[model samples]
Target: MNKARIAAAPSPAGLAFRLVFAAAAILLALLSLPQAGHAQGIVRGAQEGSYEGNRIAGPVGGAVGGVVGAGVGGAVGAVEGVLGIPHRHYRHRCHGYYDGYHRFHCYR
Candidate 1:
């Protein structure tokens, strides 16, 4: 006797289960983010600290640096939030040309 393999199609229940699982995973991930106003500061501080620490020392230093950086960053962020200080973005645009005398000038 010879047996032939048959292809099977995914069922609606399986599809629904996958979709629900994906949605739940995404929701949980989003909910896990820091909700504090200083979240950005903390994140940036940790990253910077870790990088510097790792560069200057080693793994241990990186861990310590991250903790210290996070604390400092959170404090700064809180202070700025309370002070109502707005983040500033500066754009500098200048056009310059060199003269025959090798003199450079910029005009705005």
Candidate 2:
């Protein structure tokens, strides 16, 4: 056993593995996000603005609304998702100023 491995023994393999593993983990994590967002009621891509997609994302939204109201909700969910309606956007006003160069910054 030895001390100061960083200043003496920087294992390239270990460093490479760490970097590769971290990159892979981050990539996989990011790749799984969109699906998770959808599961969490995010209607992305094509189904962004469809009202039917709204039901699937609602508190009880599920494969139960047959595209409209209760029953065969899955197909409708798919169709609604494919409708590609633009999502509505609302504007809000906010103001902020930088706090410091070496500290956390927040906004309201």
Q: Pick the candidate with the highest TM-score.
A: 1
Candidate 2 clashing pairs, residues 3+ apart or interchain: 64-71, 65-70, 66-71
What TM-score against the true fold does each predicted structure earn?
A: 0.48, 0.29
lDDT of each: 0.83, 0.49
Q: Mark the 10 consecutive residues where model 1 has the least summed lDDT.
A: 86-95
The runs of at least 3 residues in candidate 1 whose Cα sits more than 4 Å from the true structure, single-residue gaps closed, are 1-37, 89-108
- Tens-digit lDDT string for candidate 1 (1-108): 899999999899999999999999999999866467646888888899988998888999899989999998887877776676876865445677768997766775
CA displacement after TM-score superposition, residue 6 of candidate 1 (Å)? 88
Per-residue lDDT of 70-91 in model 2, one digit per residue for the tens? 2233344444445644336644
Compare the candidates by lDDT and give the number of the best one.
1
Q: Which stretches of candidate 2 lie over 4 Å from their true place?
A: 1-8, 35-108
